[model samples]
Target: MADQDFDVVVVGSGAGALLGAIRAQEQGLKTLLVEKADLFGGTSALSGGGIWIPANYDQARAGVRDDLRTAFGYMLRCVRGMASEDRVLAYVETANTMAEYLRSIGVPYRCMPKYADYYPHIEGSMPGGRTMDPVDFNAARLGVDALETMRACPPGSKLFGRISINAFQAHSMLSREFKSRFQLIGMMLGYFLDYPWRRKTQRDRRLTGGQALIAGLLTAARKAGVQMWRNAPLRELVQDASGRVTGVVVEKDGRQLQIRARKGVLLGAGGFERNQAMREQYLTQPSRAEWTATPVGGNTGDAHRAGQAVGAQLHLMDWSWGAPTMDVPKEPAFRAIFVERSLPGCMVVNSRGERFLNESGPYPEFQQAMLADHARGNGSVPAWIVFDAGFRAQNPMGPLMPGSAVPDSKLRKSWLGKVYWKGETLDELAAQIGVDAAGLKDSARRMTEYARTGKDLDFDRGGNVFDRYYGDPRLKNPNLGPIEKGPFYAMQLWPGEIGTKGGLLTDRDARVLDTHGQVIPGLYCVGNNSASVMGPAYAGAGSTLGPAMTFAFRAVSDMLGRPLPLQHADWLEQPERAAQRPAERMAQAA
Candidate 1:
């Protein structure tokens, strides 16, 4: 090997890049993983850590009969032309193989049996088991590598198996009088404990979905002897006159260094979430400030820019994996509001104080609604998620903001716990929040009435498998509870995201294709850096990570020209068994 050369050079230590590097190493290739941040994990460590893999190995073994045609059909119908046919088909067909390969390599995974695609009501949607999440791993097991990378489900985000907010409310609504009171007290105690714990822990460490995935992958990568260079941003793709990518010009420690790639170069540096100009032009929103939770410094668009210079075909430049966030005033980061989408019996209202869309619907749908609001003269301003006192008592708001966190001093003055409210009565609350009091009162009356009848006449919210899966089965009304109580609370929500989903186009084999649709020899892209397989819509929990890992596995397989064998197939087949194994031994010595 030369002074700075490897068989593969992977830009960005995201899940996709990590998987690609691992695969390349397994193929007897010397792989180098470079990241722009001091930490190894990229935006992936800041995500929900779910991977959407229809008819995956775990699902198949559980006797779920999802096929390639069905999965592809579902993707097409759900994405509705937002995703290319070839890309969708490639993801569906290779999803299972990727899942199997990762399991064999010792990445602990569990099928989220109750989760579904974002739009299950659409034709070809699966009922359950399409998404997968990483099995919980001990951070201590990561050793020195743990300190070097970010962990998903960071210490700040974990709740001790707490259900979604709506689920808790439904449970509260259905319990007997004595049971309800006891449960309320218990819930309050749990909340208090978690609140203090989260605050104290956050000051020291953050735990979240991204943290979990990165920790697991980093552990595996370290054990496999893969060298990861942090704060080394790939400046340009170095290619020979033959049009073959041979190396990269990276700026590390303020010096430009040429790192050669002998086998291939994989671009998985993530999307352009923090690129204000791109966000402004492509997203059409004035404020790009609420775009993400990952470190804002990594949004230089290095991967996209580098790929474009080499004629890599770009796809879905105008798309994103959408999320709702709360602009935490003075804080440097936005607060992600999971309850607004995951919690039932809540409604989102724009500045005009009218219901926009189904609050618990797919995130993309919510984003589209928000974008429409911006188009109608509301550019990412304050949006309110209004729910009743019933909701306040029953549902758990994960974190509370101090007066210091709020941007507006007046808004901060009204904070009580994690909720913001200004009402002695329902009408008063409505007026305080600047909504039409009469209209809000009327809407609440109708929704509460429907809860008694166990039906949502307006949005058909709880009628589907997807909605019901996230709904609390304890309540007869499921998603139809009324917000009629006095002292209604509103939590400000913003348009945020896990990561951007548009970048270099690729074939099913994960090879980077050019603008003319020709393969960019010795180049590949996977994960969030590549256009999503599901297209504009997000599926269930693990959709993002699943495809990222799958494509990475496929990219390596194509490079190596063969399937890698597992050390222990039987143990790998069992979720508990696989998750319990030591991280150091997860990946076998190549």
Candidate 2:
């Protein structure tokens, strides 16, 4: 074929692909970025948009001290034994470098100082400052010409800055009189106004998290002169006589075009969470057919299949990051488990009507527990988040719908299933939910006894610091409150996910390698298209986006044959001291 040009061709337009394109452009390599979807961003645009980077420079500046050794230890414990030590080490070490690179490219970032890993009690876990989230950007800033090309989070949703499940629970714990009603009103108003601002600004020019991140890198890529193509899908990877990849066939505008790559082809097309076949086969949950949290229309595991076609090895394909979701009526899209504001004393029960877990735990744990219950023959098909009237009046369970702006209505008419069920006694509610009424009544009675004494003897639900983080401090019983009230509530929940975690297996350099541990020449993967750096487990806040962007940056540096500078060491040495120094204070004041 004719030399169809460009030094590197990046597949997919998520964080990884965009980062790779930016890096290639920075290296002055002619680059091309192709997206199968009409819009860019992929799932990254639809996510909470946090990046978990432990021991990052921003933490040091924010009076948090975390070293590589500590971060590495924490990561290993977080992933259990699934992730290779070298891979974890490489990711943790390069986190700051990646964060700095993005900042240099004008992607604004903020440190989440109070966020903890999903398992805080795990050895080596940092209390805070392990995650970083992007500052909410004004979509209008990217300019009108770029607006139509960008995508935003689903309509009617707003992501609060550095907000944690615990923080939200704390807010929900306030008594009605002590509540910041006006602040809540203001928050709702801000969301409405901000939505229009993003839309109106984009009318002239579009800018958003996914757009801004991509646009910033696109600008850098353009300056470095990288060629990018939208609406082009890679049909297949072409190989040389030696069985090495040399080019790709792309289908665009009803025509087939063959483009040769002299260096490499990176597949960051994201995972197959939205693909019904893959979801049914791997997840084995009927709810997989309805999940809407993925990149609305296009993520179908194209990269996984394409790479597999060339003998690329795969890892963690049977596992996912895991999510607790609720099924909605209008669409199959699943919403993340909105831990009912009333969960302090509530318990999650499977269809068998047995309490499976503490409802206040992290989402990953909740998902895993539910899956296990399903395995034990509890029927994962219809699990329920059971709570009481007292719980409902306190907590906010997130927006009524996945992408909606409205708060969930207190009445059952607005919710799915029988959100409200009443019985004069605990036995009635248990029978209503189809669990072993005796088991449930016994469980509730025991729990009530423990609550009267301010303890959860059975599950130790609120005994831990992590659990207390979500508990109502003012309540006499933080966790074991009785469910003796007349009316109880149970909302149906299903397995939901931010995105799938399993994909192409790559090394520290983000190069897709085969089973023999040989790099697939001209093949690379990043973001959700590759196995997560965190493995099967997820950490707090920005876990998904953090590693995605970090790997993307590393992939770019690897493509450029350059080392990311560890400049933060100068600032990291005695991070606390440096942060507290008088000169730094003066600098901030100035």
Candidate number of the best lDDT: 1
Model 1: lDDT equals: 0.67
Which residue runs does candidate 1 get wrong by more than 4 Å? 1-3, 60-63, 82-84, 151-156, 160-209, 329-332, 377-381, 398-419, 561-590
Candidate 2 stretches with Cα past 4 Å from truth are 159-228, 280-287, 338-345, 398-433, 446-452, 476-482, 563-590
Q: What's model 2's overall lDDT?
A: 0.65
lDDT of 1 by residue, 115-233 (tens): 66667767777777787766554455675336545533333243333321222233243333346666556555655566644453332122234565677778778778888888788
lDDT score of residue 374 within candidate 2: 89
Task: Output the lDDT of residue 330, model 1.
Answer: 50
Q: Which ten residues in a row have the lowest lDDT in candidate 1?
A: 581-590
Q: Estimate TM-scores for all models.
A: 0.82, 0.82
Candidate 2 lDDT by residue in tens digits, 1-590: 63487678888887778877887777777778888888777777656556788778788678888777777777766765455555666688887788888888777776767566667777777767776766545444455565467555544233342111223323343333346556566554655556655555422122334445555655555555667678898788887877677777888898988887777777788888878888876664554645545656777888788888887777767666666766544432566753352346567676656677776677767777777778889775467666555554555453332212333353346454444455556666667767677766666666667778887665667766556555566666555566656466666677667777788778777877776667787677887788887876776667777777777777767667674544334423333432232224234434
- Candidate 2 accuracy as TM-score: 0.82
